[model samples]
Target: MKSPLAAIPGAAILTLFLALVLALGSGFARAHEGHSHGDEAPAAPVATAPRGASSSSALELVAVARNGALTVFIDRHDTNEPVTDAVVRAEMPDGAATAEAMPDGSYRLDAHWSERPGEHEVLFEVARGGESEIFPVTLTVEAGAAPGPAGGFAAWSAGLAVAHDFRRHIAEADPLPLLIGGSGFVLGIAATLLMRGRGRGPALAVLVTATVLLAGNAALGAETPTPPGAFLAAAPAPSQDLARRMADGSVFVPKPTQRVLTVRTLVTASDMLGRTSELPGRIIADPNGSGVVQSSVGGRLSPPPSGLFPRLGSRVEKGEVLAYVTPPVQAVDMSDMRQRQGELDQQIAIVERRVERFRKLAPGGAVSLVQLDEAQAELKGLTDRRTALDNIRLQPEALTAPVSGVIAEANAVAGQMASPGVQVFQIVDPARLWVEALSFNARVGTRDATARLADGQVLRLRYMGAGLADRSQAVPIQFAVENPPSELRTGQFVTVLATTEASQQGLALPRTSVVRGSNGQSIVYEHTAPEQFQPRQVQVEPLDAARVLVVFGIGPGKRVVTQGAELLNQIR
Candidate 1:
């Protein structure tokens, strides 16, 4: 009999081996599932179906020859913009031919060479104004395939069923769950071995583990169907209603629901123009319109004549006294004032007595009129000095508003002593706000700049100025808000869209419409058929504040989902 420790290693090895096998099998199933059942079918002969061309650069050329004439499509690699008014010269198998430009940015040439049924390489050179590109394309022309009998529908249906079955099996065969369950079973087996001497416990545990593994494997197998009917039942059927593929490769949403979700469409058209840039920005107070109120001298703070402190969000006129800064008087100053008051009072009394004597003597000719006048003036001056000394300890300085606007910041507290030059309040005129954006490119001029707030609100921008000095390798561009709403706050971060004089034409769609593809490429779902949406990779550029310009991948008149794209991307 094997020792318990020996059994433990065996159980662990068994579990690991089983997990590895399941994982390998799962990978194979996934690979098989992604392939179409009819992949082995021969390619169909060329026909007059609607043709399209895509390129990875400025030189993708697709030419179709029909009835002794050839039609060509030319597009730029990045933006998929059509190259119009280009002089196209193609070297055919027999001779060279010059193509004429069509209104739709395509070219056409009369087929002067003999019609042949073979693969031929055609060299094409396209020139427009100052730019030119060369494209080499191979065209294979063969006899059209004959139509099959109507009864062949069953075979097509069978092939679709098989493909779906493969997909279902692939989804079910994910091995992580199986590996976990297998680990649990092996642990149970080890426990059983450890308790070998216990009555019936080891046998019971072994039986239970075997039963669990068999059941679990059976469940995993049952998840995928081998027959056509089983596959149909397992897979979700494509709904008659229009559906779009989400970012995560999931499906099943209706068009009416999409419209309710604010789904908008864009028709792609491309042209060569200037490139745009998006920069991070923030909402700031206009320097000319915002001001901070600070105390000029240190003293205790008190409310103005209104007896109420100006609270935050309160509007105040320029130069309005918002608070009172009462200059604090020390005990020594108070004592000095009191002493001066007593001295002035005594002086006044002595002068008053002298003045009284002088007035009596002036009438008796004992004193001259000048002496009486002098004595009276001294008594009046002494009385005035006493009154002035008393009032100095009672007055306080008033703190006034520096600007005419709303109080955005208030740090004032009642009876709090404030230091000299300490900012007590910040005033901002909300009606005249500004946005500061950091631009990596030096902006020659701003044409149609706008700012997008975090809450999705967009503010119109008027160009103020661009700084020459570089900050963090970016220039600061200032834009004054044209119409600011109440929700806008100072120092709030925002996204600024600054338009340059250069122009480019492309399919402009809402920024939310594009999603990241599995391969990490930018992709948008094209409503290809009535009920199916195919993912198309696109090259995107900044268009404006709310939208992105699709330069490639789709064409004009195609439908796309704008809103609920993220939700669609979440579908598995």
Candidate 2:
């Protein structure tokens, strides 16, 4: 009853209606899909949208316009304290620029495109509050154009368009067109089988139609471009600007403006001399060549004939009198000495007269030869006792230096009374000093040793001996300084470096070259590209005073940031 041509138009209309429904369904599926794409929300039309504060506490930001310049203010999440003196950097559309923080925790910059229309994406890097936060905001300027319709068929169409865009973006995210193509091939087989009752031409036509649909889907999928946030998940390029070697074999550092940085360089060269082993050491006096001058007798101390008390660092010769000790005599001893002197004087007078009488009577036969001999011997003894009494009042014990060296310690005062056995001065030969260090390993027949002063001066050392006694789980190793300076003193603590028979090969770098990373790992910056620097972890061992032996993680001839390393680390 109905014409076949009439049915063809209806079937075509039905096919068009199904296609529209399928397209609409796909758009709805995409609109409901809820997943953020990188740092951006897929639903956000503008690339830069103000996100909810990720801070655990409060979020504060102050936007100020100063002298036609736009200034930004950021503070602590909770405390609202001004984050002054922070290193704030902004990623603008033009490029990166450092922002100067004002006194009130506000940052200012000249916004040349403030009057421009459209939404601008601003990325703020605020390094404060002991952490770094990236604040991305989209500022839309509505200079013209009224707000459009909020809801209606037009709004729905707009929403559909957005959904379609989202679906397209997702399609470009994966390779699913190949599966669709396989499905189309299977459909084509079914169509051919179903059309077997008809002519082969019709069946082939159906198969070709299915094949074309599959091919069209595949082609559309292949033509889709990647989404905006797809590249963010890719691997990042290595940072190579930290310690790059220059064209002239030197490191170029532009950190901290290169002015306030403390950068030092060491010129390298090779020479044929005795191998040196720098050791951490301290100044000490030679135990054998030094002595403390002490007062044995308790009495008032007086300067020697020089009339000047030996001060610290004064040079003194061996056997030179540093001070005099006047022994205080007791009253009983004084009385006894006086009585003895009187008795000796009287005896001397009596002996002198007896001797005279003996000499005269000898001629007259009044005295015998034995008596004259006894009288003369008594007179000689009396005269010796009288002479000793006179010398006792004028003499005092002189404290003399036992070593020829500088005065390492001088506790003497001009009229101060010194107790018995109290140390008055310590004389040490600074030129011949020694250093004592403790080593956990037992050092036997040490081949070499060295001492490094705190002022960066190196001292040559000769192995002296190692004590058998243990001190703090370590053996004491002593070394004699080859040629010490005048500044060396006794009882000064120093580190001693004693080399064993073992040897190791590695690149030795200065201690300043190594810096601790934020993750508590030891890292060193390696110069890779011309303007890029990457961090490399390293294992270090103590080599000497100023240098450390990099036992692992770094090769020779690599440009490392020896100077201005701290400044380079400040880069975000």
Candidate 3:
């Protein structure tokens, strides 16, 4: 009762399987890279939210439409500061509506016309700071276009279903895969029947299973319209207007994101500004308010009467004794001193005996009164010299502070040998710091100068003087800090911007506003639209510590981002 397929060789079945696999692979390869076989093209990039922008000489206005509502943003044209209390009224084709000010510094209007898909002219009348202005903007609304796709598991599953359908369509369009699959299916069924021999029940079950599988695949591959109720309800999702970089190298930031980033802007304006030069400098102690403790002669360092040398950062007043320097006497010098002492002693003893003899003889008229007086004076002089020599050997030099300040440096140690003219301690007044900068130019202005620290802190400086001599091919200029902070330390590096007598006309912008572009050019972000920022390459020059002069590339009346520009550049 064995069927004819039961006698077929196993090698023949394997050969058919390999042929089927090769055919399907070749079909997939062609579909993947050769051409498109599906009806739907790949989805286009998601568009930004609909918006309109308009600006005038004094104010800038922008409107964004979302959820059947239109939100308007207004700011000052000069400073780019948000205008919170402005009254905004919009006149549209259907009707007129007044906008309510929101806490987020935006005006919201309930515009029923925004839901309709068409171009609408909007006249916005804004009044703030006792001034009123009218701005006209054209807004376009697309019909049946979702702001963005839904989120969560529903969206993910929907995306997977779409991909599956697209793959099925490609398989259907290519006939090679279908032909191979059908031939493989027939061969597999015939082999199963041949192996079953006389078992009719099992053979019938296999036929039914194979038929069901083939029908299921056919159903999945076919195109069918889905009912609206088939899908779960669209859940509440966050807005899709996110901050991203555009293809044109611009950045698109939504209003909400801007608020979170605390982005601020400034309207650039050109004016005649004084020229300035930047110089490398460092903080130094003021000459009049700083002091150095040193030994005039080689000596041993000892603590003051308080029994301790001043530690670093110790505060001391002027004339406060800090330490004592005991000069070491060499053996030869000691011997010489002893010899001088002995000689003085002998002289004093001899002079005393002579003076006594003269005094005693004066009364008998054998010696004159003037001679006795002179002999006594010689004895007094020898005694004074002997006493002074002994005092000099025992005395120690007391070192005191010359100015009131904190000890910035300390090299003193008890019983430590100190060389002459060697600095033992350095005292600096924290409140009286000076910045020394190397300036190549001679005619630097003495009126305005500033020092910028690494942490972006700026200190006002008063010009002291510039050295006539050249140092490192530059003149050394000294400037006294007007009000230095306590955290300032001597030897800390800084950038000194000193004003010059020359003047130039340019737009001055904050240093943070300028950033380096991908191409290595200096660029600044301009608020071109309500939620869009464009990069403008600019050439800059030194103006002051906090600002730079823009020579060109951007003109006046454009809003330039000041704060949060670095954050804006990171968008991708």
Collision pairs in model 3: none
Mind giving the per-residue lDDT tens digits that candidate 1 earns over 266-294? 44555555556777998889988999988
Q: How accurate is candidate 2 locally (lDDT)?
A: 0.60
When summed lDDT is taken over every stretch of 10 residues in candidate 2, the lowest stretch is 45-54
What is the Cα-based lDDT of residue 354 in candidate 3? 96
Worst 10 residues of 1 by lDDT: 43-52
TM-score attained by model 1:
0.53
Cα deviation of 381, candidate 3, in Å: 2.4
Model 2 TM-score is 0.51
lDDT of 3 by residue, 224-300 (tens): 43322234323222355678888898898876688778788887888999999898999998998899988888888
| Per-candidate total of colliding backbone pairs | 6, 11, 0
lDDT agreement with native, every candidate: 0.68, 0.60, 0.80
Which 10-residue window in model 3 sums to the lowest lDDT? 227-236
